[model samples]
Each structure stands twice: as structure tokens, then as C-alpha cells.
Target: MAYTLGIDIGTYETKGVLVDTAGTVHAQASRGHQMLVPQPGWAEHRPEEDWWGDFVFVCRALLQDSGVDPAEIKAVACSAIGPCMLPVNASGAPLMNGVLYGVDGRAEAEVQELTNRIGEDTIISRCGNALTSQSVGPKILWLKRNCPELYAETSHILTSTSFLVQRLTGEVVIDHYTAANFSPLYDVKTQSWVDDLADDILPLDKLPRLLWSDEIAGHVTPTAAKAAGLAPGTPVTAGTIDAAAEALSVGVDQPGDMMMMYGSTIFIILRAQSQVSDPRIWYAPWLFEGEHASMAGLATSGTLTHWFRDHIARDLDPAQAFPTLANEAAASPPGANGLLMLPYFSGERTPIHDIHAKGMLFGLNLTHTRGDMYRALIEGIAHGTRHVTDTFAELGQSPKRLLAVGGGTKNALWLQATSDITGIDQIVCEKTVGASYGDAFLAALAIGAVRRQDISMWNPTDRTITANPTADYDTAHALFLRLYEQTKDIARDIG
Candidate 1:
């Protein structure tokens, strides 16, 4: 039977899957890696270790575990956390670690400088995105200004997915969906890279060639085949960001469909009928031609839960901590016992785009327990989701169907709270394998083995979390907004 291989590099883990043309999983493997924070407002990943190394390890494991012949796998695809900023030298070796996504706020100054220089109205009109930490253009400018020596040595700039695809196929290429994040560098109208907005960032030749997500980039080289335990000459597709893959995996195909990813951060992607020209959110050309997507994200979500578990609930066994905390949170009343939390541990993204925003646990009293605090943390994330959804509604593009995916969906309390707070029902799919599974489907699609509509057959809806709105949550959400506004200045002052 013909099979496909899909791998995804995530913030804390990497997952891979081997699947047949019929979408049956033959084998799956995963590995974990760290997001290095060398200093405040910066996030980096050792591209050689965290990205390529994990890919090789997971590929070998999947092959061995499934006993699938390398040649039998028809196509290979990858999706990774992006739009990361990584500079590579002449031979494709990483010059430095990969700068992470919106969570890393080191380029805040560059973002502002470019905004002031180019004008925000012009940027939004041309790129369909604002200059935020998520944009790769400002990050590239940051490298040039802050690390002049390394910048001088840089021959090519690549995002996480581009780096992976190049390693596999020896072709430096990026998908339109991911390339759109390079605001002021990428022109949404033309769907191509342009230097008119910021000619000083880098030469156009240094950027990767652009392609659609499903287009064939190149074939695997003998060297890459040996390292990744795949067949030489195997086709590789132009991969995209992990969030886009996650959306496709859950059947978020129509214009009104939105994927609410509950991973390291809360990333939302809404399929749009047309380009959305708003700085508060993001706009990108969809995986295919002539399509559009609107995106918004929170800097911290599942990451905040990890912090609470490690710092507040350390008394519980690490293995049992999240489940124990969930039960405790369920016992606490809604509104988290009058406590509210601001989940800006790494800073805020989307809508506010405040990099200096601080995390606060308000309404804390001696009467509060770990359960209340944990519940508040989850509720805070829910409030943030509501903010994004409300923005979409205001734009007259609210999601007609919200599909929830990722590790956090297992947390019943978190799932219900998000629905209750957002007043939107969320559909959960049967297989929540996320981006990697979507990668397999994309691989199949690239090779003409499967149609786009077949995703429903691959993974159908298991259930839906119905919205049960309440006045208490509405009051708490109002306070949540007020708390951030009232204390944002203090957050910056403390920094």
C-alpha cells in the first residue's frame, strides 16, 4: 500500500505520522525540545538540534516502528512553528538559532521603527498585515541592526518550514501562506516578495522562492535521504506554518471555518472569502491560489497552564498534575472564584500587540486555592479568545464553525470555559493528531492521491462543545479588559 510521511516541529514537542492512502495510521512517533530564552523578550530554537535533529529522529522512529519501506512512502510534507526568523549561510547551515514567533518580543523596536518609517496605513494596504512581533520583516531588521556580524555572514533567510524543506529537497522555498507574515517584505496584492517598502531589510535574492503550499518544491537528495531515513528522489511539498496544517487537519476548509489551536499558544485561523485589511488581526493568502485567511493569536495559553502546574501545583506528581489541577478547577465555581488573570507571561499578541504587557493575578486573597488560580488562568485565556472572536464579528467575519484542536482540548474545563465565554460552539474532531496528520493529508494531496474534500472521511466530527453563556462571565470579561488597560503602564514601568 502506498503511504505518506508527515512531521511537525512544535514549541515543546515534535510529532510524526505514517499513514496509508486510506488515512489509516501505520505508525507515529514524537520527540521533545526546548524553546530557549537566552534573555527577556527573546525566544530561540537551535535549528540544527530542535528542528532538523527532531525531524531525523522522528522519521527513523516512524520507519522502524511501522516497518514501512522508504520507497513506499509517496510524498513527504512538514509543518513547523513559524514565521520564525533564521539566517543561514552559503551551504544552508544555520548561522544562528531560529528566532521564535510572536512570543519573542525582541524586535519590538524594529516593528515600531518600520511602522513609523513606512507608515501603518501603507503597510496594511500593501501587505494586509501590521508590523508586529509575528512579522518576519521587523525580525530581519532586528538581526541586521543588533547582530551586524552574523547579519554580514547571512546568505539566505528562512522560516522554520522553509529551513526544513530545504534540508530535505535542497531547494529554498516558502509557501505563500507563511510568506505573507513577512510584512513590508511580502506584497499581498501581488502575492510576491517586494523590497519597495523596506529595501534595507535584505536583498530579495536572500529570500526563498515562493510556491503554493501543495506545490512540489524539490526531490529529496541522497544525503538528506540517508539522514532522514527516506528514499532519495522522494517528492517534498512546499510546507506551511503549523497552525495552517492544524486547520486543514480538522476540516477548516470553507470561508467561514476557523480553527482554534490550543497549543503552546492560542492561535486562531479563519478562512476568509476576501482579504481582511485590519491591523488588529492578520491576513494571508490561503494555501491555494485566490483564497484568503485571517489570523489572531495569544502569546500564552497552554504555556500558562504549564507555568501554573510547575510553580503553583508542584506538590502534585508531575504526571498527575494537569489532571489533578483540572479536577480542582472544576470544583471551583465559574468566574474562578472572583479571581482574574492576565495571560501575558511572554507578552500579548493580536488586537493589543503589547509586548511589554505583564501577567497579573488579581482578586487574590488568603481564601483562594490552587484550583481557583488555575481556573482563573484558564478563564483568562478564554477571555483572550473572546476578544479575538469579537474582533472578527466586528469585521463581519465571525466564524460560522469553530473547530477546536490540540492537547488542551482534553481539558474539559478549559474547553467548556472557552465556549461559555466566547458564546460560540466548538467542534472537536476524532483524530486530534494536529499538524502532523494534516501534513500527511497535504502530502497525499500534493501527489494527487487524495482530494481536499476527503478530509472529512479521514477525520470526522466527534462532538461539539455547545455555548452556554452567562452574565457572570460577561462581567468578568469586562473586568479582564479593564484590568489590562489600568495596569499596562505599570507593566511597562516595571520592565
Candidate 2:
């Protein structure tokens, strides 16, 4: 039986799985890594150590653990935390640590500079996005301004996934879903790189060739095959970013179908039948060429929860702290005992698009306990989700089905709070192994072993998290918006 290998390089860890045509995971492996915060508002991952190293390790381990013939695996696919900015030389050597997604606020000034130089309307019309912390073009400019020597020496600009694919097949390519974040540099209408707009950001030649997500990038070369303990010429799909893969994993393919990915950050991707020209949210062509994707994300979600555990619940074992905290949070009342949190630890993204936004713990009092604070954090991220869903409603793009995926799906409090606050029932699939599972599915699709529509059968919905009426959540959501509005200027001043 033909099997497929899927690996994902995430912010805090890398995970991979081997799956057969029946969607049964034959083997799985994981490796944990740290996200470097060199300074405030900066997040970095070494591509060599974290991205490629994890891939080789996971691939070899999966083959060893499964004891399956390497020749039986038909294809390989991968996803990663993106739209990262990794400048590389002609030899594909990384110039510096990869700059992370919206969380890394190093390019805030560059985002503004681009908007001023090229009109915002021009960018939105041509690129389907405005200059924000998430845009890769601005990050390239950041490198040019801050590290000119390195920038001048740079021969190519690639994301984490692009770097990995190059390592595997010795081919440089990026998917449209991921390339969309390279706003102003990527032409959405033409679905290709436009050197005219990109010239000021970086040399036109620095960008990778574009392809749809499921298209075969290239076969793994002999060198990569030996490195990864696989056969030469194994087919590999043009993988996407983690959120897109998670959406695909759960069968989010139709119009109005959405996936609320609760990973290190809270990401939402809504499949739109037509183009959504919204500056408040991002717009990208779907993984498939003909479809469209309307997306939004928070700067921090699970990351904030981790911060709370590390600082507030530091006494507990790191392995067990999350479960313990979840238990404590469950014991607390729904409104988090009058505590409200703004989950902008890194900075806010989506609707507000405020790069200077700071996290706040409001309504904290002598009566509050650590459990209450923990509950507050979960609710805070939920409130943030509500904000994005609200945008969809306001824009007449409300999701027909909301599929919840990623680690946060296991946290009942977080899932329930999100549903209760958003009033949208969420569908949880049987397999929440997340992006790696989607990668396997994409690999299967690439090889014609499975069709795109087969995801519903491959990973069926397990259960639905129905929205429960919550009086406090409604009030808390109002205050959540008010708090951000009131603190807008203050956050900018302090930041």
C-alpha cells in the first residue's frame, strides 16, 4: 500500500506523520525547538537548525519507527509557520535568522514607508492586501535598511516552506496562498510576481517561482533522498503555510467554510467564492488556483497562554502545567471572575492591524486568583476571535461552517469560550494532528491517490462544539473592543 509523508515546522516544535491511503497514521514523530526572541517585538528561527534539521530528523525517524519500506511512500509534503522572511544567497544559504510572521514587529516602519511611497489603494487593488507587519515585502525592506550589507549580498527571498522545498528538490518555489503575504511584491490579479512593484523592496529575481499548493514542486533529488532516508525522485507537493494546511486537513474547501486554527497564534481562513477586497483582513487565492481565501490572525494566542504558565504557574512542571492550568481555568467562572485580557502580547493583527498594540489585563483585583487569570487569557483569545468573526459578519462573509483545529482545540475552555463568545458552532475533526496531517493529505492529492473532496471521508467531523448562551461573554466582548479603542493612543505611546 502506498503511504505519504507529511511534516510541519511550527514555531515551538516540528511534527510529522506517515499516513496510508485510508488516512491511518502509520507513524509519527516530533521535535521541540525554541523560538528565539533576540529583542522585544522580534521572533526568529534558524532555518538550518529548526526547519531543515527538523525535517531530516522527522523523515528519518518516521521511516525507522514505521519500519515501512521507504519505497512504499509515494509522496512528501510540508507546511510551516509563515510568511517568514528568510534572505538567502545564490547558493541558498540563509543570510540571517528567519523573521517570523506578524508577531515580529521589526518591519513596522517599513510597512509605513511602502504605504507612503506606493499608494495604499494601489497595493490593495493589485495585491489584495495592505502593508502590514505580515507583509513579506516590508520585511525585505527592513532587512535592506537594518542589514544592508547582508541584504545586498542576498540573492533570493524565501519563506520557511520555500527554503525546505529547495533543500528537498533543489528547486525554489512558493505557493500563492503563502506568496499573498508578499503584498505589493506579489500581483494577485495576475497571480505572479510583478517586478515593477517589487523592485523597490528587493530585486525581482529574489522571489521564488509561484505554484498552487497541491502542484508537484519537483521530485526529491538524489542528495536530499540520501539525507532524508528516502528514495530518489519521490514526488513532493508545493506545500502551504500551517494555517492553510490545517484548514485543508479539516476539509475547509467550500465557500463560507472556515477554519479557526488555534496554534501559537489564532488564525482564521475563510473560503470565499469571489474576491474579498478587505483591508481589515487579508485576501489570498485559495490553495487551489480558482478559489479565494479571506484570512485573519491574532498576533498571539496560545503563545500568551504559554507566557502565563511560564510566569504565573511556573511552580508546576512544564509538561503538566497546561493541563493543570486548564483544570484551574475550568473551575473559574465564565467571565474569568471579572478579568478581561487583550491578547496583543506581540502586537495586534487583522481588523485593528495595530502593530503597537500591547496586551492588557483589565478588571484584575484582590479577589482574582491565578486560575481566574488563566481563564481570562483563554477568554481573551476567544474575544479576539469574535472580533474577526464580527468583521466577517459586518462584511457579509460569515462562515457557513467553522472547523476548529490545532492544539487549542483540546482545551475545552478555549474552544467553548470561542464558541460561546462568537455564537458560531465549531466542527472538530477526528484527527487534530494539525498541519502535518494536511500535508499528507495534500501529498495524496498530488499523487492522485485522493481527491480534494475526499477530505470529508478521510477525516470526518468528530463532534460539534455548539454555542452556549453566555450573558457575560456578550458584555465582556463589548468591553474588549472598548479597552482597545481607549488604549489605542496609549499603546502607541508606550510601544
Candidate 3:
């Protein structure tokens, strides 16, 4: 029987899994990695050290643990935290550490310059997006301006997944879903890199060739085969951004189907039959052809929980402690007794698009306990999800049922609060796998073992819980909006 291998590199760790055509995971392995915070509001990773090295280690680890022959593996696929800007030299070595996604604020000035040079309306019309910190165009411009020497040496600019795929197969390619985040750099209308725009900003030839997510880009080379314990000439597919893969992992395959990815950040993807040109939301091609997705993201979601655990619950073990915290949080009533939190610890993305937004805890009282604070944090992230869902509604592509996936799906309070605050029913999958599992599924699709529409059969889950917002909770939500509006200026000022 044939099997496939999937690997996912995330901000905190690298994970790999081995699975057969039936979707049953045979073996899995994970390795923790460090994030480089050289300075405040800056996040980076060394592609050689963290990205490639870990990819090799995890693939070897999976093979050894599973006792599966490398010859039996038909293909390998990878998914990674994306829209990362990594400058590479002619020899494909990293010119410098990768500047991470929207949370990294190193390109603040370039964002302003791009926004000023290209009027917001023009950018929205052409790129299907504005000059937000989330888009990769401003980040590329920032590299050219801030690090001239490094930019000059850059032979190619690649995202996290593209970087790995290049190393594995010697093919430089990126999928449409990942390329869309580099708007104004990629021509969304023609589904190609914007040549005119590239001449003005980035080098056209340096961009990776764009391909559909499931297309077989190349075969694993002999060198990579030796390093990864895979056979040479194994078919490798062009994978996608981690969130898109995670969406696929949970069976988000059609219009009215939405994916709520709970990870370091909260990613909301709503599918559409046609293109959606919304400046307030991100526009990307879905995993398959002839489909599009309206996307929204919060720069910080699980990060907020990490902060609370680090600052508040330092004495407790994270694995067990977070559950205790959630239990305590559940003890409190909805709305955290009027406390509202703006979960912009890193920055705000989607809807507001404010890179300078700061985290705020509003209506905190002297009478509150640690549990109340915990409840407020979960509620805060839920409110952010509500904000994104509202944007989906405005775009005429609202989800009928929100499917929750990732580590955050394990938290009952967070999931229930998400349902209650958004007033939408959420389905939690029984066997929730993150992006790596999704990448393996994509590998299966590439080999013609499964169809895209058959994803629901592989992913099955019962409704664990349904939460309804109370009248009082509705009142608090209204107040939550007003609180953020009043503090918007103050948040930016402090930042």
C-alpha cells in the first residue's frame, strides 16, 4: 500500500506525519523551535537554521518512528506559516533572516510610503487589497529601502512554504493562495505576477513561478531524498499557506463553508463561487481552480492566551494549566462582567488594518479575579472573530456553519464563546489535524486517490457544544464596539 508524508513548519514548531490513502495517520513527530525577537515588534526566523534544518529532522524522525520504507511513500507535501518575506541569494542561501508576516512591524514606514504612492482606491481595484501590513508588497519595498545590500543580493524572494519546496524539489514555485498575499506584486485579475508593478518595485524574474496548490511541481532530488529518508523522484506537489491547508483539513470546500483556524493567529476563510474585490478583507484563490476565498485574520489570538499564561499563570504547566484557566473562565458569566479586551498584542489585521494598534483591556475592575481576566481574554478573541464574520456577511459570502480547527479547538470555553459572540453554530472535528495533515491530503489529491469534494468523508465531527448569546451579552457586545472606537486613537498613540 502507498503512503504520503506531510510536513508543516509553524512559528513555534515543526511537525510531520505519515498517512496512507485512507486518511489514517501512521506516525507523527514534532520538534520545537525558537522565534527570533531581536527587538520589539520584530519577528524573524533563519531559513537555514529553523526552516530547512527542522524540515529535515522531522521527516527523518517520522520515517524512523513509523518503520515505513521510503520507497512506499508516493509523494511529500509541506505547509508553512506564510506570506513571509525571505530574501535568497543566487545559490538559494538565505541573504538574511526572514521577516515574518503582519505581526512584524519592521516595515511600518514602507507601508505608509506604499499607501501614499498608490492611492488606496487604486490598490484595492487592481490588487484586490490595500496597503496593509498583512500584504507582502510593502514588506518587499521595505527590504529594498532598508536593507539595500541584502536586497541587491536577493536572486529570489520566497514565502516559507515556497522556500521549503524549492529545497526539496529544486523547483521554485508558490501557489495562488500564498501569492495573493503579495498583492500589488501579483496581478489577481490575470492570476500572474504583475509585470508592470514588479518593474516599479520588485524584480519580476525573482518571483517564484505560480502554480495551483495540488499540481505536481517536481520530484524530490537525490540530495533531498537522502536527507529526508524519501526515495528520489517522489512526486512533490505545490502546497499552500498553512491556513489554507488547515481549511482543507477540516473540509472547507464550497461556498457558504467557512474555516476558523485557531493557531498563533485566528484565520477566517470564507469561500465564494467567484472573485471578491473587497478592500476590507483579503482576496485569494481557493485551493482549487474556479473558486475564491474572502479571508480575514487577527494578528493575535492564541498569542493572547500565551501572554496570559506567561504573565498570569506562570506557576502552572501550560498543557494542564490552560485547561484549569478555561475552567475558571467558564465559572464567570458571559461578557466577563462588562470587561472587554482588544486582542492586538502584536497588531491588528483585517477590518481595521491598523499596524499600530495596541492591546487593551477595558472595563477591568478592582473587584475582578484572575478568572475574570481569563474570561475577558477568550471573549476578546471571540469578538475579533465576530468582527471578521461581520465582514464576511457584508461581502455576501457568509458561512452557514463555522468549522473550528487547530490547537485552540481543544478549548471548550474559547469555542463556545466564539459561537455565542458570533451567534453562529461551530462544528468541531473529531480528529483535528493541523496543516501538515492537510498537506498529506493534498498529496493524496495530487495522486488521484481522492477528489476535493470528498474531503467531508475524511473529516467527521459531531456538534460538541452550541452557545447562544444572551440579551445581556448582546448589550455588552454593543458596548465592546464603542469601547474600541473610543480607544482607537489612544492605542495607536501608545504604539
Candidate 4:
């Protein structure tokens, strides 16, 4: 049987999966990488050493583990942590480390300069996004102004996924979803490069061709094929960002369907009939034709849990410790005895769009214990998810169903709390291999092994968690709403 390979380059790790057309994940491999922090709020990844190195490593490992001849693999797809910035020369060598998504804040001055030059209205209208650290246009300009020598040699800009595609296929192509984040530089209406904006910085010709996520970008090159143990000339599709692929893995294909990704960051993908713009939410064209998606992003999620465990609860082992913590949290009643936390460790992204906001824990007193603090942290993330859900309602686009994916869905406590906090029933899919698995599915669809709508046939059993907001939660939620309102200004000011 013909097989497909899917690879995902995440912030902390690169993973690959080999699968048959039937959605069975035959083999999988992953390798961890570092997140460079040169200064406060700056995140970078050396493309060659970090991104591509790990990608090639995982590809070889996955192909070996599958025990299937690489020649039998019909196609390949890639999903990456992006809306990232990677400036490359003509031969596709990284000029410097790629600026990471939202976590990186080195482009602060660029954001301000773009907002001043283009005005906020024009940015929103053209890009369907705002001048936040997430946009790549300002970051490109930042390189030109801040590092002239490196910027001078830059020929083309590539997102993380596009970078991998270029190496594999010898063709530079970017998907609309990832390209849309280059606000004021990517014209959303035309769905093409905005040559007129960057007159002197970079040429329009350097930009990669744009394609939908599932469309064929190119075939695997002979060199890449030999290294990856794949058949030469196997078709490679224009893949998408990790979040978009995660959403697809959960069957988010139509309006009112939403996928909530619980990972290093919290990302929501809500399917829409047409393009909708909200300053609070980043918007992108859907992977397929005839659909749009609105993104609700929080800069931190599992990252917060990692911080607490690694730094605060250093003595405990996470495998054994998290369950103990969960039990302790369960012992405590809801609301964590009035302790609340605003999970803005990496700055708030969705709803508020405030990059200056800092993390806050409120209502703590002598009565609170370590368990109370732990419980409050989980509740804080639940409250953040509530904010995202509320924004959807506010925008007149209420999702009828919420599907949870990634490691976060594995935690029953979190899933229940999130459901209760948002007053939405959460559906947990059993086969959640996440972005790589989804990318494999997209490849299957591209090669005509499966029909697009027939994805439901492979759906995992739904373990539903319904969070019914109680009168007690009503009081707590009212306070939760006001907590951010009263503290947002202070968080920004202090930062």
C-alpha cells in the first residue's frame, strides 16, 4: 500500500509520522531542540542547525522506523510552528536565526514604525491583522534597519514550513495561511505579495509562489529524497502552520467548527464562510478553497505549566508529580479558595493584543498553599480559554462545537475546567497525533487516497466533557472578567 510522510517542526521539537492512506500512524519520531533567548522576550532558532537539522534527522528516523520502502511513499507534507520570520539568501541559506512566533519581541520598534507609517486602519484592512510582534512585515523591515549587513544579502523571506518545502522540492512556495500573517506586506484581497509596500527593502520577485495548503508545491528533489529515504520526485504539498494542521486533525472543516490547540501556546481555529477581521483575533485563509479561519492566540499555555514545574516544583518528577498536583487541585474546591492568576507570562495575544502585559496571580493570602497556587494556574488557563470563546460570541460567530487536541486534552482536569469555564462542551479525539498526523491526512487527500469529507470515518471516539457553569462559578467568573479589566492597565504599565 502507498504511504505518506508528515513532518512538523515545532518550537521545542521536530516530529515526523509515517502513515498509510487509512490514517493509521505506522511510525513516529521526535527530537527536542533549543529555544534561544539572547535577551528578554527575544526568541530565535538557527534555521540550519535547529530547524532543518532536526527536520532531516526526524525524517530519516521516521522512514527507518516505518520499515516501508521510501519508494512506496506517494507524497509528503510538513506543518511547522510559524508565522515566523526567516530571511534567506539566493541559495536559501539562513541570514540569521529565524524570529519565532509571538514569544519573540525584538520587533517592537518595527511594530510601532509600521503602525505609524501605514496607520492601523490600513493594516487591518489589507492584512486582516494588526502591527503586533506576530506580523512578519515589520520584522523584515527591522532586519533592514537594525542589521544592514545581513539584510543586504537577504533575497527571499520564508516561513518555517516554506523553508522546509524549499529544501525538499527546490521550489519556494508558501501557503496563504502562513503568508497572511505578513500584514501590510501580503495583500489579503489579492492573496498575493505587496510589492508596492517594500520598495527598497526586498524585491517582489524574491517572494515565493503562493498556494493553498493542500496543493502540490513540487516533487521531492533527488538530493532530499536520498537523505530522507524517500522516493525521488514524490509529490510534496504546500503544507500549513502547526495550528491549522492541528485543527484539521480534529475535523474542523466547516463553519461553527472550532479546534482548540493546547500546546506551548493556546491557538484556536474557527472555521468561517468568508473572511472576517477582528483586531483582537488574527485571521487567515483556510487551507482549502471557499473557507476562512479566525485565530485566537494566547502566547503561553503548556509553557506556563513547564515554568511552574521546572522552577517552582523543582524537586518533583512531572510524570508522578503532575498527577499528585492534579489530585491536590481536585481536593481543593473550585475557585482555588479565591486565588486567581492571569496567564500572561509571554504577553497576552488574543482579545487584548497587549504585548506589554505581564503575568499576575491575584487574591493570594496566608491561607493559600502550594496546591492552591497550582490549581489557580490551571484555572488561569481555563479563564484564558473562556476569553477566546467569549470573543467568538462577541464577534457574532459562536462555535457550535469545540474539539480539543494535543497534550492539553489528555488532562481530564484541564478539559473539564475549560469546558466549565467556557460553558462549552469539549470533544476529545482519541487519535490525536496532532499536526504531523493531520499533515499526513492532508497528503492522503492530495493524492486521492481519501475524500475530504470522509475524514469522519477515521474519527476517534469522542470523550465529551461538559462544563456546566454553576452559581459559584458565576460569581467567580464575574470576578475573573473584572480581574483582567482592573489589572490590564497595571500589567502594561509595569512592563
lDDT of 3: 0.85
Instruction: Identify the superior model by TM-score, candidate 2 or candidate 3.
Output: 2
Q: Estimate each model's TM-score.
A: 0.99, 0.98, 0.97, 0.97
Off by over 4 Å in 2: 470-472
Off by over 4 Å in 1: 469-471
lDDT of each: 0.95, 0.92, 0.85, 0.85
The model with the greater lDDT, 1 or 4, is: 1
Model 2 TM-score relative to the real fold: 0.98
Q: 231-328 in candidate 1: lDDT tens per residue?
A: 99999999999999999999999999999999889999999999998999999999999999999999999999999989888899999999999999
Candidate 4 residue-wise lDDT, 406-436, digit = tens: 9778778778878888888888887788899
lDDT per residue for candidate 2 within 43-140, as digits (tens), equals 99999999999999999999999999989999999999999999999899999999999888888888888898888899999999988989988989
What's the CA RMSD of model 2 in angstroms?
Answer: 1.2
Q: Which ten contiguous residues of candidate 2 have the minimum total lDDT?
A: 467-476
Cα RMSD for predicted model 4: 1.5
- Lowest summed lDDT across 10 adjacent residues in model 4 is found at 195-204
